[model samples]
Structure formats: structure tokens, C-alpha cells
Target: MTGAPAMTDSLLAVWHAYRLPILVAVSIFFVTLRVYTQSQSRPKTAASSSVPVSPRGQSPEKSQKLDAPAEKPIAPQNPTTKEIFKPAPKSVKPASGPKRVQGKKKPAKTIGGRRPSNEDNDNGPPVSFIQPIVFFASLTTTTERYANAFFPPQLHDISYIDFDDFFTTVPPSSSPDTRYVYCILIPTYNIDTVLSTFLGHLDETHNDFRIDTAPLANLAGYSVFGFGDKEEWPTEEQGFCSQAKEVDRWMAKLTGRKRVYPLGMGDVKSDAENALKDWTEGLLDIFGDILEYGGLGEGVRGSGDAMESDEEDVEDEDESQSGKKKSSTMVDLEDIKMNGDSAAPLPVDFTTVGKAVTVTETAKEMVPKTSPTYTALTKQGYSIVGSHSGVKICRWTKSALRGRGSCYKYSFYGIKSHLCMEATPSLSCSNKCIFCWRHGTNPVGTTWRWKVDEPELIFNGVKEGHYKKIKMLRGVPGVRAERFAEAMRIRHCALSLVGEPIFYPHINRFLEMLHNERISSFLVCNAQHPDQLEALYRVTQLYVSIDASNRESLRKIDRPLHRDFWERFQRCMDILREKRSYQRTVFRLTLVNGFNVDDEVQGYANLVEKALPGLVEIKGVTFCGTSTSAGAGLTMKNVPFYEEVAAFCVALNAELERRGLHYGIAAEHAHSCCILIASDRFKVNGKWHTRIDYQRFFELLEREKADGTPFIPEDYMMETEEWAYFGKGGFNPDDERWFRKNAKPRPTHLIPAEAQAQVDAHVQAQDS
Candidate 1:
């Protein structure tokens, strides 16, 4: 059975291989037939659903025909290859009928009354980018008469605009609506006749342009022409010429237009009428051309051209009468004369008659309606007019004035003057310090509302203001006429006067006015307004009133505007560091008896290391002004013993040396005021040298003018403590007892034994 089964298996295996091939072929045929049958029987399904169409709108057959081309297979497009043939989109034809209306049109939006667009930004009105020009006219008593003649109030009012206003007003208005032409007219000449005639012409042509003819004041947007005989000029008249030349130079510097033409009858050789015609023609021709080119307006060109041309025609008449003429046209002179009705006497109330009084009641009685105090206070809406120029004037009481008595002080420039003026006229502070000398009633506004008074008035008022009180101190020796004159000129403004003058918006302008007038300023600040301080280009001496041991103490003493007062103070310290290159900055530390005295040595040393000021004044607090409260609280004495203060200073000096700093005691005056100087540049030969240049120093001082800082005259020398007080004391050279009583013996430990021996030997040799 096994053999039979084996043979059957072999046969089955062979048969299975052959049958498998046949079975595969039959199955493939049946599957192919079934697929073919299914494909033939089944209806074709679209790749996507067909969209529905309306039968009423179009016939089904037409729609089918229209869609038949879409049913055909579309060939894939290759963007890289160009198409051989492409069908264009079918254009839709509108029905032959009128179009339907949709909506109403909207109005366009506007910006500032003009259409809004990027073009609006391009054509927007221009902003004024011009910096105001400052013209400083040096006016003295000798020049005042000429000024009064040249610029009469009725003829022209130039006093209303300041130097800055003049500079800013030079460029004419761009707006077409404004008709006025602002012009500054400065006439510089030796002949009164020529000036008189010009004034006449100005009055006749007043409708053409607004004329500002104030002497020493600037006119804006106006052409300035000078008038001079060129033959007869005064010695003081040279200054006027120089000033005119300066103005011309400034104009040239600004506009890059150097050539200037003069208009006067003096230059022409014809009758006054003929000269006037020529002058008027030339003016009209030039101005008419300018106006045609849109360079000037009819307001500036009108009768100004005719009047100016008329002067040229009359030049010959001026030359004919040159030698014999006492003055110009009699009619012109008469035009300025006050009319009989117009010449009504100035009211007695308007006259500046008496001297300022000490007592408030007395002062009120003598005060003129024209007084600065009266005008300013009235404008400020304060009916309470007192003796002071401002409320702070009360601080300059008889006692306060007497306590801080006058002394013969010399400027670095060798100009001798008494330290008379006590308080600054403007009193608005940026820093509300605990130790300020200003009274509570002082005006705290940040700008000067009233016009600045003439220096002469300020000087006279001070003298009349403090007459008897100053005379009482005549007992003090070494007082001289020169000193008294200097005292009268004592408009010395202490920067720390009452408030922070730096905060005044017009501080720079005010200082510029003072500087031009040769007024010295000493600006002192508590280093609160760093912006104002940094803006300072000059000052006699920049004083940083440091009254603290640290940032905490600074905040406590100086209630500053910023929360980061300490940081600002440090920035001020850094600024002072730069001053070493051009300024003589003084870092003043008001040493209270018990408050900051203990930590002063280290604190001052740190400041010295940072700032490296020209002088470091370490002084005891004077129990004056608002300091009385702090003084009483701290039990501070006004006059601390000089020896004791000297010792403390000496110790501080030694400590400074150890830290690589060299210092010397500069002065020990009334209140133990010891000025310590960094001895890096100071030598023993009496020659004072500094890293900064003198010109730079002057420039720096000039920059500080607005701060109301009194300048240490260019000739004043900083006195050493020995020369200032000790050497001039009662301790006579002949009296050994007196010398021993006053002078503090040097500490032996401070000098090595060998060094002492050498000094002793040297002294012995010198004696021999």
C-alpha cells in the first residue's frame, strides 16, 4: 500500500503543477469578463457633482451643449512651458437697457481744513527753525543823550522788544493774512540833523511798516542801515560805529549777504527835494523788485520805498549845509517836539523823584509809580507793594545788612568794589532747600514778568535804599572813595541770592544783558538743576553748595525737584569735573557744628577726588536767613574759633595727602571760612596756574550770567588764610606773647625729627 500511495503522490504532484497554471488562466479570464460586464452595465459617475440649472432661463439642450466642452478631459498645464493655443474667457454682454443707480457719493475727509493725503504731509505749513538773534547795546550815561534823541517814544517804541525777540522777528511772516511788516531800525551817526530828518521820514511813512527804533534794542524782520558823516565822529561815537559794524558782521554771518547799501542825503549832491526823489526811487526800485519776486510784501515796500528814495535825492542838500548846518530840516526837528497840548507835564505820581527808603512805610511813600517794584507787583495782581523790589527784599533788613557788613573786595581783574548789594532782584528758586536765605514771601515764579530795570536805577536805588545803614559802618577802617564807588556799583548778584535763578526761563537772556553791561555775577546753586548748570557756557565761579554727608543727607537738606536728586547731584559733580578744564568751580560745604562736621573729612575728600574743583571752601554755617532754624537746632555758632577750625582743616589736609590729594588752607575770614585748594597746579612762587585757560574761564563765566552769579573779577586773587586774617591780626611781630596767644604751634609729630632738624638749621642759616 505504501508503494502504490508513493506512485499516486508522484502522479498527483506532477498533475497539480500543470493544473495550477490552467486554473490561474481560467480564473483571470472569468475576472476579466466580470469586470468588463460590470463596466458596460454600470452608469458613468462624474468626478464632482454637477451644479443645478434653471430650465426656464435656458433650454436644457442649449445648456447641455454649452457644458459639453467642460465634460471633456482637460490636459494638465505646465506653467514652465508656453501654451501653443489658449482659449480666451467668454465676455459677458450687458442687456441693452439703462443702468440702475446704487448709492450716494461721500464727501472727502480733510486735515486741518485741507484734503488728507500723503501730499498734505509734504505741503504742510513750515515750522520756524530760526534761532533768535541777540543784540547787546552797551549804553552808558554819555551815550544816553544820543539814544534819547535817536529813539523817542512817540516816534518809535523799540524798548518793547528784547534782543532775543529782535533776532526771532528778523524773518518776515509766512502767512498771507498778516499785513504788518516788523522791522528793526538802528541809526548810527554823529549828526543830529541826519537823525532828525530820518525820524521825520519814519513818522511820515508810518503806514508802510511798523518801525521799532529803540536805542540798544533790536528790531525784527527789518533792514538796518547806518547813517554817519564819516568826517566828524565823537570818541564815544567809535563804540556806535563798532556796534554797527558788529551788527553788519552778524547779518553777514547769518544771511551770507555782505554788501550793504546806505540811504541818506549826506551821500548825494543835489537839493533836499531832488535827493529825496533819488533816494525814494532807488528804494522803490530795489524793494519793488524784491516784492515782485515775493521776497518782501507791500507792507514793507509801500511808502518806505518813496520815503527812502526821497532821502537820496536830498543828499546834495545835506552836503551843501554840512559845514554851516547846526541841525537837519527845521521841520523834521519840530516833528519830534512835544505839542503844547501833548506836552502836559508828567504826573507827579509818574515821576521818579526821591531815593528809596529803608522802612516799608517810608519806602511806600517815596516809591514812584514808575518804580520797578510798583510796576511788577501791580502786574502780578499783588496790591501789597512793600519796600523790597520783590517780597524777598524784606530779607535785606537793617540788621541782616549790618550783620553781613561790607568789605573791600577786589575782582580778579583788579577792579576794586565794596561787597554792598545783598539780594538778587529776581527771586524764584528751583530748589526748595532747608537752608535757603530767601524769605517765604519771595516770588516763586520761574520767569521775569516785568521788564528789567536799568543798572543805574538798581545802583541808585540800592544806595538810597541802604544809605544810613551803610554810613553807620564808616568806623571800619580802610574805606576809600574808590571803595564807596565800587559799593554803589555793587549789583553783585549771589547766585544763591534768594531762589534758583537758573530756573528762570529768561535766565540766559538776563545774564546776557548783564554781561553786555559789564555786570559781574557770582552764581551759586545746590546742584539741583543740572540742565541749567550744563547749559552754562560761563560764570565768575560755579559754586556747588554741598550740605550733606551722603545722598540721604542731600535729600534731607536740599528738597530737590527730582526724586533722583542724588543721581542728579552726582551728575552735577561730573559736570564740575569737566569745569576743571575751563572754569574755577568752587565746591562749598557749609559745615554745621554737629550735623555734617563729623563726616566732613571723608565726604569732602571724596568730592575732591571726583570734581577736583579749583577751590573747596569748607565753612561754618552762618546763622543768617533761613539757616537760623537749622543753626538753632544743631546749636551751630556763627563764629567758630579759627584755631579749632584750622586744626580740623589741617587734619583733613593731611588725610587728603594720604589719598594722593594736595590741599592748602586758602582763607579763614569772619566765620571760620577755610578755602582748600587742590595744590596740583599751584606753586610756591606766587604764580597761580590752572589746567584751564583764562579765555575759556571768561567764556564759562559769560555762560553763567543768567544764574545771577557774581563774577570774581579777572584781577581778584584768592587770598591764603594767613594773608587774609591771621597775618593782619592783632598778634604783633614785636609781641611774642600776642603771637603765642593767637598762633597754634605746629604738631611735632607732623614733622619728622630729621626734617625738623633741617628746617631749624635752615632758619639758623637765614638768621645769620
Candidate 2:
């Protein structure tokens, strides 16, 4: 027993002496094994492949000490789980070459890996360690060229893959020790589309892919950028910078990262040096940062400059064109012909100029910067129209297109509703008439307080909007294809849509555009701007909406915004009376039941005598319902019955007789509860002169430019008859004469008599 204890003591002493050295050796072995296992598990991607970078050019490993705490690891997946990522086809070779310059073409490759005879296979060394797989979408050839110039291959390891092949082009499978940095470039033209598409990939369907994006939440590890032309943006204020701001917001919401850079480019070649160069330099810096650091760098807020412009230059141009030196009512023939050679300036008169407001460059700023209200209006069957104007598909217009019925204008004056386009040059109105059916929520202004769009732009936009409306109606249940086709080429423009058309500072210019387009204009003014009336050129039909008879009723019904409302109304009437020559002037009285239809017939007659309109249309107020604020205040009681309207017309005719005026009830539209009174002046040789000779009117305008010679009212007057009215024997659709009188050819098309005849026949057939 003593011998055994002595042996144990000796072994214990030996162990105690070498304990420190033994522990050190075992620790070294475990450290070496752990590092080796980690290296083996690392991803085998190309050396120059994309990786997250830091703001300062430092490697991720070196910057690791500076960064925040690392994200927690995702739970391990089952080894038996099937891999979803498939390998790319062998036929598809990765792009490899020296960084190519923009506009340089690569040699064509032969089918199935065979080099074309024209090219030399002397394929030089690969310029980059990683052959990039770029995916591009919705980019035009020119855009692609520009993008290539910005991201040269020498600088970037990018592969330009077709946008369609992106999702289908399977990515490399993820491993426990490795993650990929995906960079996405989107076009600003289709921002909504591209963003939605990218987000769609992260839906529940991708849950089984075992791709964890937790690391990207803190660091902008996955890169995404947008680029587009600055000019293509909707507005200057909301264009480049605004869109970029939106991108930033959306990125933060979707990816939980606030890293997004939008590179603004030019719409034309001139912008290359300014916008394009700056973006290119910025891109290079981004690449350098990414290469140095292992994460996306700090987001770029500004690229030194944006699509900046000189406001003074634009104002100077506007001043030069509008000519502030001249009288507000003066129409310069030379300036009128500036946009188009065929147009002539309308006659100018300063005799009865009321206190008017001119829309200068300063006032342009007051104009609604955004049209959110108009955007909502579009959803209510309105057209996708105008830069600053609006057009709506009227019930009458819809009915005519479907051969169901026509508008009151069609029955009153031989106007064809299918050929008419209802629009407004201005969305703001001076008066908020209580009986008005338009949306009460529309913008209102006392004077011209907004930017006036160019006539050419307005005309083109309105016509395009009309075309879109007709196109949409093509498949509608009641709309006839043939009628819809006729509606595409507008013949007449009714300026009675919503706001006052004359509210636009360029009213005369807009009228000239319409005349030049061979589209007859029917301008309706609320008599608030007499100066505009004096400045206006000739139109097919000019209706003054005499909402009330005298000063008190006018204030009550019309609700004029101007403090000198009575003076303006009287002055506008005087100008209308003077403008009877070369234009069809009419006084439109909306007969309200408990409002103006009382003992005010004499008052209306006296005012009518003073104006001496060619025709006086006394129509019952239509209860278009009260959705608008002004409309909400009005009730159905204000609407007059057909019998009540007829009595008022009769009383007004009697009053006209008392004043020795030759005005008489020529026609009536019972459906609209409207009565048309034709003055004896229009009844030359016992025939009604209601229809307009649009061709002769334009000829006179062109001829009378030099001496400012005014054409007489009889110059373009056409014969009308009592039978032409609704319920009259003259209202036959089969009557070719009536059709010819109403269905004039638009400037856009050579509308043959056969087309009008076909439309009439269709309407008659439907009625039968």
C-alpha cells in the first residue's frame, strides 16, 4: 500500500508541473479548427462580386469595430429541404470584356457559340474578375446607351440583363455563412410599375426560399436607385427632387432602410455635360465607397444641381409675347399669327373697358400648383385633358353619341351634339351662379389670377382628351361605334363647361386656335369681364348668360365677385350689343321659378332691348342635383316647369312688342323647357337667321385684319325656320338641309355629307 501511494504522488507532481503548457496547446488546436470550418463554409462567388460598402472607403472587416452591433442569425433550415434556385443554362455566357464606352458596338456572335466570320475570336483577357449579370427593363436604346456610358464595365462589375429575364434568371443559392448584395436600378418614367414588381417577389410565395434580409434592415446592404429625364416629370417643383424624395420614403417603408439615390438626367443632348456628367461622377464615387467598405455608403441628397432654370428669362419671353405696353383690350394681328400663319387677331375695342386684371408672370404663381381636385374629377367620366383646362362628357353629349338624344343647343340652334366638345380654358370662375349645375367645389377668382396656357397646347390637349373620351366609349353598352368615330374629330367647342372660358388671359388666342382648327367656337361669358368681351374675336355663337334682370336680382343669382359688378354687367352688355356684327350674339336667361320668373319679365325685356341680342333663349333652370356647395344651397323648387317657362317667354315677347323690338318666339324645346326668341333683325325676308356660316366668317376675319374692318351681322347669317325647333315639323332628322346646316366639317377631317346623313339616319332609326 505504501508503494502504490508513492507512485500516485510522483504522477500527480509531474501533472502539476506541465499543466500550463498542456492547456495552451489544447486551446490553440480548437481555435485553428474553428477558423478552418468557417473558411470552408464561405460562399464561392467571384472575387469582384458586389458587396455592401460604408460611407468612408474602408473594408467591412476594418470598419466592423465602428459599426453597430451585428444582427442576430436566422434560425437554421432543414438540410432535407429542396433548393429552389436552379443553375443558369450553359448556353448563356456571362458578359466579360474591358469596360465598354457608350455608343461602341460589340462584334456580333454567331449562333450556338460559333464566332461570326466578321469577328476575330482573339477574345482578349477578361477585364474584370467577376462577369456581371445586369438586368434592364423598359429602357429605350438611347437610354440604354446613356446608362452604359454612366456605368462603364472597367469601373463596374455589372451585367445588363433584360428586365423580363430577371426573376427567371435564378440567383445563386444562399449559404449559412454568406449573403448577396442585390442592386436594383429603376426608370423614373415607370416608378410605380418597377417598385410594385420588385415588392411582388417578396410575397408569401418566396417564403420557402430561405433568403434572410434581416442584415439589410439596418445597413443599406441591397442597393436600389432610380434615374430619368427631368423634363418628363409632371411639374418643376415636383419633378426630379420630388420623385427622389418619394423613392426614399417608399424604400424606408418597404425595406426598413432609408438608402435611395435618384439620378436626374436630361431630356435632350444639351443636358449631358450638366446633369449626366455630375451623375456619372457621383456613381464612380459610390463604386469606390462600396469597394472600400462592405456596405452601401451614405445616401446622396443632392447632385450639386438639378434641372435649374432662369425664371427671369421665361418672364421676359412672356412679356415680349404678351406686350405689356399695349392696351389690355388691344389685339395685335402680328402677335396673333405668331403661333400659326393662318390665324388673324380679333378686333380690339377700348371704349367700354372695365377694371380688369391681367395675368402676369407673378400671378402665374397663384395658379393651382397641383390638380388633385381635377385628378378626382377624371374618375367621374371626365377626359384626361388639358395642361390647365378640363373637359367632361356631358349627358347630352353621351346621349347623342349613343343616338339616344341631343342637347338643347342642338334643338335651339342646329348644333350636332356628337360633333361638339364641351370644355373650359379656365377652371376658375368669377361668379358662382346659384342655378349653375357645375361642381360648386371648382376654383374661383375675381380677376385673371392664374397662368394662361398657350393656345396651341390647350387646343392639342383638349382634342386629345376628346379622343380619349370617345375611345373609352367605344365599348360602352349604348354608344354606337360609328357615332363615336364622328365624335373623335370635334366640330364645335362649347365654352360653357364649368368655369368661364373667357377667364383665361389668352381667350382670344384660344379662339383663334379653334378657328384655325376649323372648329367653330360657342363662347359663353357671365358678363363679369367686359374687357375680355371687347378683346374677343368672332365666334359661331356668343351667349351672354343674363342670369338676372336688374342689379338686385343679378347680385342675388349671379353672385358676382367684383365689387363693381353692376358696372361690369352693363359694360359687358354694351360690348355685346356692339359685337353683334360678324358674330351670333344671344342673351341666355335661365328662368328660375321662385327667383327671376316673377314680374321681372319687363325688366328682362328692357335689358334685352339694350343688348339687342340676335336671339334670346329663355330656358327653365335644370335641377342637376346639389352635390356642389352652391348647389347644396339650392333646391328643386327653383326649377321652373315647361308651362311656367312658356308663359315667361310670352310675357317677354309682349314686353319686346311694347318697346317696338322685332323679337318673337321662333322655336321651343319642350324637353328642356326652353324657348328661343328670334329678333326681327334676324328675320330678313321672312326667314329665321340662326345658323352660322363658319367658313365665310373666317374668310372675313382674314380679309379685315389690315384696316380693322368689321363684318356686318348679316355676312355669315344662315336661314332657319320655325319647324327646326323641337316638336316642330322642321325638326325632322331625315331633312338633309337641317343636317347640312348643323353638321359642319371639322378642320381635322373632310366630314362628307354622307357621314352626317348616316348619323341622322341612325338617330331616326333608333327613335322609330
Candidate 3:
């Protein structure tokens, strides 16, 4: 009985241990089942309540709209805890409140105004005179309305006050009582203070004078004048002054009244006293007998008899004033005087400017001097010296057609001095092309020798020579007196006046010296002197005369001196590529018909691609001077028609685009010449049109000396006047016949008769 009891107790202990493990297992299973049922059934509950179920793969966070009725089933309640855990079936509530989709959200509201269209932005500002005046900050709507009323079109002939030129000081009682009304309009920074001071002065005035002051808008038939320094006026004040809405509203208020005349004191550069004196005189001229001791309402002291006497006095005063005004109008003579003080007599023995200058010696020594005959003429007084180098200088004289067009005739200076030197300073070049306008001389040597004359001596000699030339031309007929005076003023230097300056060994140093003297140098080179070109100092402009298209054609047309000239030409182009720091490298292509016209476009494009010059001047080859060798046939016949030339430029632009280059024609002389710009930067309407900044052209030149590569893109090297010349290529050729029929032979009126004749002959030949 004791053994049985012990076994039973052991069995009971084992049963108790296993009972706890089994209970735990059962609790875990029920919990797992409850979680699984809740997850699956929650979505069913949502579906039964008319909520769209999310797709199987979609996250619950992403709410999607119900496109079609979903076929989800309602979850059954758990059987074990039906009463405790079961959800009561949802009862359909009566339609109440606002109906809303389960997950859809309302869109946000747009603030401010709707977006503006492109056209609205493009039409930015209105086009009106008042608008521009406001834009310049010269007048505000506050003042503009007064100006319009005072200067109304209906009162055009009526005398009005010119406050800008009037009221020098308080008038004396003895002064003639002319009917003139002096209206002084002042725009003071301290308006209130100035007005108070003016009122005090008026209050202290005698019975002979009267004064009145009114707000700008109410001041009808009154003159207006602005007084404020541009620097003094802050940007905010200027903006307020230029408000168009304010101006228009003011004008509307003064609809019937005479508008106030507006003027500014800043326009004239004179002391306040002088400006006031001038303004008073102008008022006297406008009003004759109406001026009185007091205001306009006061009767004249002197009656009709006084009018006659006053008229005589007025006429005399008017004459004196006119003479003084004319004298004042003359340009300041001191400004015209040569700025340089280094003047010296010529070394030659010949007296009188004309006899002292001679080109015969220079012509003979051309190979040594590497200077043209024109330079010698300038030294002899046949031309005026404006700018100079050791071997060359530019001379200018007034045109016989006084001030009608470009009235300066240019010539070369210093050729005679270099020629007289015995060291053989001249370097002769070959290639007497038909386009050349200089005297054709035989070629001599390939190199230069001797130390050239100093630049100072050349300048002085040129200047003296120029004065002498004008004195000689003074007696000549058809010359205006003004032109003769203008001939004495030398302004510009053209280094490439006649021949290739590159041949001179001292050419580089000469250019450097010219630059130092503030003389702009324009050097033209014939590709023959590639070596010399390589060693050249980049001047204001470096022009290469591209006269032919292909090597064979160039040989035939250019008649080069060296057999390897073509190779040297290409080499020169390559050198130009290396000297990209030079901002004004220009490839001047002389266009000729029946020669290389057909291929010139392509040839120019290729060369431009290689050289990447800053500009390209495609001009007609002038048939003047020695070029008369070709005469009427080659000279006249080889000129391209303006239309054809324009077309060719268009095609060239197209080619430039194909090569990934950006180019535009800068200038056009119609049938004569067209300039193309290749720089990445250019200007239009006072704004930059390209990536290149022309303002930085000089700056880049300074910076680029250390690194010769062009900071600008290579492709933007050839810009042509395609739009102006061809007009997108659809216009009728005869639409504008003026250029072909009546256009001037050349755009430059300063070109000599011989040059003009050559250009005319070329154009006529092309037309024929």
C-alpha cells in the first residue's frame, strides 16, 4: 500500500509539469489565430463599408481610388468568441453631412495672380515719348503733365517762357518794359525751403514787380525747369519721378489748362549765373512789347510810340546777341591744337612744304624702306600727318565736298626720310594684283636693312608736311574754307595705307612705338611675308589681304613673288591661329567675279576655320591706280553683283553654322563691302548679343598674352551680315534696286578720286 502511494505521487508530479507546457502552447495558438483573423478581416470590414481595398502588393500607406466595384468578401466572426470578439454588422446610416471619398484629398489653392503669358512679358513697356522721358529720370508724371499743358500744340505760335535761359537777377526799374513774361521753373532737392525763400524775395519786391507760385499741376502757361544733379537723385526718387500712372493721372486733371513747359538745368554745362542770363535773353526774344515793370497783367508804360523805338533797340540787341551766339558756337580752338609739343623743321633743304616733300627717292628706295610713295608725299607737304611710325605715318586732309560725307583724305607719311637713307631700309614685295591701288613697282630684295628714322622725327616731319600741303591746296577751286581748316587736323592713322608693312624688319617695334604714342595702328599684310607676320606685334588691327581662293587661283591672280608663297600663306594663317590674343585680327577677303568668286566663300570659311580671326571684311576689289592694268575688262568685269555677293555671304553663314560656328555680318557697304564678326561677343542696340563681351576685348588681349589661346570659342570666328544682305533668302532681287542702280560707288566718301573711280568701274563691270 506504501509503494503504490509513492508511484501515484510521482505520476502526479510529472502530470503537473506537462500540464503547464500544454496550456502555454494552447494560449499561443489561439493568439496567433486571433491576429491572423483580425488582419485579413479588417480589410473586409473596410470593403463592406464601401471603402476600396488596396491591391495585394500595394502598401496601406498608398491610398488608391476605386475605378470599378471591388469583389471583396466580408470576414466571418470567430466561432470561439463570437459574442466577445465579433464586430456588429454596420448599419447603413441615412445620407448625412458632406460625402467624401475615403483617401482623396482636396487640391491646394493658387495664390496671387495667374501666370503671365510670354507675350505679356515681351510687350514689357509701352512705346511713348513720355515713357522714355520717365525712363531717363528727367521728369516725373508730376512734371510731365504740366509740360504737356504749357506746350500744347494749339499754342505752337504763341510766345512761351524758356526758364532755362531766363532771370539772371532781379530786374532794374529803368529796364525797357517789354511784354516778355519770365517764368523761372526750379526743381530743388529742398523744394519747401526754396519755395519759402522765393516767396520772401517776392514779398520784399517793389510795386514794379510781382511774383506768383503754384503747384506743378496748377501752373498753367508756365515754364518749367529741372534742377538736380543726376548723382544726387537716389534711385528710389528717380523711380517715383518716372511713374507713368502718376504722370497720366496728372495730365488728365489738367485737361483744359495750358501745359507747363519743362526744362532741365543739367542739359547745359555752364555756371548757374550764366545759365540764368542765357535763359533771360531767350525770354526777351520771345516776347516783344508785352514786357512791363510789373507782371503780364500790368499795362505797358511805353505806348505805340515806345513800340517803334523799342523795336529799333530790340533789333540792335538781337544783332549783337546773334553775333555773340555765333562766336560762342565755334569749337574751342585750343582743343584743336596738336596735343604733342615736339615740333621740328624737316632735315631736307627744300623750302616751302610742297618742295620739301618728295616720293621719287622713296619709290627708288621702296625695297629698303618698305614704305609706300604716299608716305613720302606726306613728308613733302602734299599730305597731312595724323599718326606715324618709323617708316610710315597716316595723313588726312579735308574733302573738297565740305562736311557732306567722310571729309578726310588719307595719305602715307615718312616715306621720303626712309628712302633717302642709304642702308637699304626698304623691302620690296612681288604680286601686282588687280586689286592693288598703289603704284606698281618692280620687286627688288626679300629682306630689310638699316636703322630706320626715329618715330618722333617722322611724326614732326609728317605734321609739318601736312600743314604745308593744306597751304598749297588753299588756293585750289572747289575746296571749302572749312575743309581747308579741317585738313590741318590729323585724327587717324592707317598703317596699311598702301603696301604690306610686315616686310619691314622694324615693323614690330614700329607698331609698339605707335601704340605707346596712343596712335591706333591698322597694319595690312600680304601673306607673302609670313615670317615677318609671325614676328609682328599685334596692333589695333591686323589685316591680311586675302585676294584669292585656291593656291592655283591665288598664283594666277596674286602673281606672288616666291614659289612657296602659297605654303607661306597657309603658314601665316596658322600663325594667326597661334596669336589668338590679338583681338582685332581681320581677314580682308577682296571679292572679284570670274576669278575666285564661286570658290571664295568656301575658301574664306576654311581659312576662317583655321585662322579664327576676330573679323572678316569681304569687300569688292577696287580697280584704281596700278590696277588699271586690267583696265575696263578685268577691273570692271570682275566685280561681283551686290545681290550675288550678298547671296554668297548668306551661303557662307550657312556653312559656318554647319561647322558649329556662330557668325553674323556686322557691317555692309552694300555693293562695296561687308564685314563679318567671329568673336563670341558682339553688341546690338547698346547690348551684348553674343557670349563675347566687346568691352573685354582689350582686357582679354592683356590677359591672353601669357596664354595665346582665345578665351572665346573657335566656332564664333566668322560672323556675316546674312540677315541684312539676304533677308532669309526669299526677297526679290530687284525689290531694292537702289544699291545696284543708285547706290554710291563706295561707302567711304574720304576715298580719293582714283579709288572712287576704281570702285565705280568695278561695280559697273559687275553689273554689265
Q: Mind giving the per-residue lDDT tens digits that candidate 3 earns over 409-483?
A: 110111111111111112244454645543232222233322345545554664465455456656755556755
Tell me the lDDT of candidate 2: 0.53
Listed in order, each prediction's TM-score against the native is 0.38, 0.49, 0.38
lDDT of each: 0.38, 0.53, 0.38
Stronger candidate by TM-score (2 vs 3): 2
Shift of residue 569 alpha carbon in model 1, Å = 0.9
Q: Pick the lDDT winner.
A: 2
Q: What is the overall TM-score of model 2 with all chains considered together?
A: 0.49
Per-residue lDDT of 1-768 in model 1, one digit per residue for the tens?
699999999999988767534543453344334433433532221111111111111212232343333332222221100110122111112122112212111222345664333223222222111111211111111122222222221112221111122232232222221111221234343221112222322222221123222211111122333333333443324543433443443332222121123322321112322332233233323322222222222223222221123332265468666786333222344554575765423212111112111112221221235433344444433232222232222222222233322221221121122443443434444344444543222333222223344444443453354443355445644344444444444444454545565654445655555555455556777776677788985665577888775874554344443435677788888988887665557777775544455556787788778888776666655555432233223223423344444445655666778898766543333322443444545434643332223344445455654576554333333322233322132121221221225778756564345534543443354236
Predicted structure with the largest TM-score when compared to the true one: 2
Number of clashes found in candidate 1: 46
| Candidate RMSDs in order | 37.7, 28.2, 37.6
Query: Per-residue lDDT for 43-125 in model 2, tens only?
Result: 32122333222111121123335334333223212110011011111121212211111111122234465422212322232
